[model samples]
Structure formats: C-alpha cells, structure tokens
Target: MHAWIIWLPVCEAGRTFGMDSLGGWMFWIVCVCFSVWENAALKVNMRESSLEVVRGDSVILPCSFYTSSRLSTLNIIWTLARSSSPETPIQVIVYDYGQVIEDPSLIGRVAFTGLPLSADIILNYTRLSDAGTYRCMVNNLPEKADPGIGELELSVLEPPSLPDCKWDGDINLGGSVRLSCSVAEGVPTPDIRWEKVNPEEIPLPINMEGDFSGSVQIVNVSSQTSGLYRCSATNIL
Candidate 1:
C-alpha cells in the first residue's frame, strides 16, 4: 500500500537493482558523501565537564553536548573508578539511551535531568562505598565520534569512635538508673547497639537516634541491666 515499501521490493527484485553503470556509481557516491559529512560534524563539537562531593554527601555530575544542528541521537554513560592500583578498576554506574540504565547498587538513588542532548545526573544518600573518581561520557553524534567526558570525586569520612558511657551516681538494688553511649560522626549513618557486662544479661530496650550525637538509649531501669553497657555503632558505609 505504501509507495516506498512497494518500490523497495521492485527495486531489489532485479539482479542489478535496475541501476545503470553510471547510476550505480552515483548511488554509492551519495552514501559516501553523507557518511563523510556526519563524521566531520561530530569531530567539530566536543567538550569536558566535572564535579566533586564529600564522603557522606550526595553529588550530581553534569554531562552535555554542543552541536550545530538539532540532535536526534542520545547516549550517556556514568562510570566510577578507584584511585588506587594501576589496572583501572572501573564500574559502570549508569548508561542511558532515551531511558535510564538499571544498576542494582544505584537503584532508587540515581536520576537524570534535562533532555537527551543536555542533562545532569543525581546520586542520593551517598555512602563510603560510593567514594571514588567518576567519569560521565556522552555521545549523540550522527557518526562514530569521541564521547564527551566529565570527572567527579567522592570523599568518604571514617566512622567516629564509640563514646564512653556515664551515669549520674551509684544505683540501689531496686532503684532505676540510666546509662549512655555516644557516636561522633560517620559517612554512613551509624546504628547503635548495647552490650552488657554479662553476656547472658539482656540489655533494656535500646532507643536509637537518641540524644547526643546519634547515641543508643535504654528505658525503664532494672538491676539486671545495670552492668557496664557498651554502646556500639556500625556505619552503613
């Protein structure tokens, strides 16, 4: 029904595609000319960009392209590489072609901004595991072309040491008392747990995200919970 589809079969049915000696040369010439033009255009426009972030904080790396004509193709890639060792240990963080790539480590934490030709990437709830040098590459050229590059740095902070626990005064056998432990800082939000002097003794219900630098808490005092309460924090990183 369509003129182009009907003509395509008719044209291909012929042994020589119904082209004369001169016509065959002209067809190839046209294809070559278009290919050369595309290659030249891509070589003319190329750029680089970058970003940086602290270990606990999140960051967005910008990647974009500049072309003389409106872009019809889009390709973007994000990668992370450790600074140590010489083997170039690189991991693909994201790869996009009209849709975002699904990476298990970055799921629900990565997003793309702006249109296909120009865009910025966002990472959420960063951790020490995310620390590394990153590269963002973009390719939207009509022909095979060099990709645009963007570098990013993620800084991770070590977890702070556990703080000493203290009480106001000595407790009677049946009287209620309170003990506390503190955590200073960490890239990954730390979780607090309480360990008593006696392994068999069960510590009181520990309240987390409590007062004093994300410390752990125990309510309703009892003699069984009175032994040395050790506050421990484990960072997500």
Candidate 2:
C-alpha cells in the first residue's frame, strides 16, 4: 500500500507548542487531511529464499508476482549486492514490458529463464564473487504492491584443493620437527587433520601437538613419534 505525506510550514511550528489541546487538535487535522493511504493490489514473492551452488555451476533465481495490471505496463528489475560490498547494488537485469536489458558486466552469462510470465533468471558460470543477495522488484504502476520486492541469498561453495604435506627440521630421535600441511585454496578454509600412520594404528605420542592451521609439532621426538604421518584437509561442499 502507498502512504503519501505532505509537509506544511504551519505543521512544523505546531510541534513547538508541546502538544497542548490546540496543538494536538491541529496535528490530528493535518494528519487526516495531508496523509492518505491507498491499498495496493500487486503481490510479489520469491520461490527460493536462499540457494547454494558450487563454483563454476549455473543457478536459477526464482521470483513471481501477481497483479491485475496489464502486461504492457509490467516492469521487473533484478539487482544484486555482492557480499564484498553489500550496500552498493548493481543492476543485473531489467524487463521493461517485453524488452530485456542486461547489465554489461554480466552479459552473455545471465539470461531470463522465464520471461513475461515470471521474473525468474539464470546465472551461468557462477563464481565465488557472485555470492551475494539478489533482489527482484516488480512494478505495475498505479497499483502499488504491499511488498513489491523479493530477496534471495546466494552462496557459492569452493572445495579445498589437494593438500601438500612437508616437514621442517630433523625427524631424528630427540630432535624437534614441525609437520606442515596446506591446501592451495578453499572456501570457508578447510580444516587440517594430522595422524600417525603406523602398522598397528597406535595413538599419537604425548609430545605431539597439532593445529587446525595445518601444522603439527613434536618436541623431543622418540621412537614412538617416528612413523609415517598423513595430513587430510576437508571443507563443506
């Protein structure tokens, strides 16, 4: 619905009167005369409130609207605010009547999945940078909607790369050594796990300390600490 507000010089001065009987009466009259409410008939809703997809994948953002307005007057706009700069919105696409206009930066990679009848759109070759909030706004002019905007949160997942394991310092008995494990890249950063790989699958030595940051230290290493070690990295899909 729409609420139109108008300001008059007298209204501003009335506030200084401290809401006395006369001031209160004038305020009520001004509100009743200057503020008007018009009921809206349009309705917009999002089909999927949120979505998650892997990097390099294609994803569809769904939006729908119902209005008694004619098709010739319908206008739909799609905008996005990337997670990096959430306050700055970039127009992704616009459907004015029957013509479709796409943002230059996303041209050839984005297209309307369902046009004219729906506001759904598809994004191809999704990247980690594409993770953000998307908005769909529909306007039918004279018939304002209570909520003409729908929002969807998009997340792009990246799996951890193959981990590289190495050691610093000597592995000899009574010597100190630092075992390091790392992945080239990963979204949400992968967790690193280090384990001693012995024939009997024995427990790790008490002198060994491991860290999720991909490092393990063994102080005063002994026979118990001398064995093959494995490092594994994992992250959410």
TM-scores for the candidates: 0.44, 0.75
| Candidate 1 residue spans exceeding 4 A from truth | 1-56, 83-96, 144-147, 158-237
lDDT of 2 by residue, 75-174 (tens): 9999999998999989999999688999999999889887778889999999888889999999887788869999999999899888887789877778
Give one digit per residue, the lDDT tens place, for model 1 in 1-237: 111111232244455453444566666767776666656533222233334455546776665655544455666677777544325645455444556774676787777766655656677777666667766666655545454665666566666566666655336655545566667665445666676656564544575545434333444557655556666667654
**After best superposition, candidate 1 residue 137: deviation in angstroms?**
1.5
With a 3 Å backbone cut-off (N, CA, C), the pairs that clash in candidate 1 are: 55-155
Q: Cα miss at 134, model 1 (Å)?
A: 0.8
Q: Pick the candidate with the highest lDDT.
A: 2
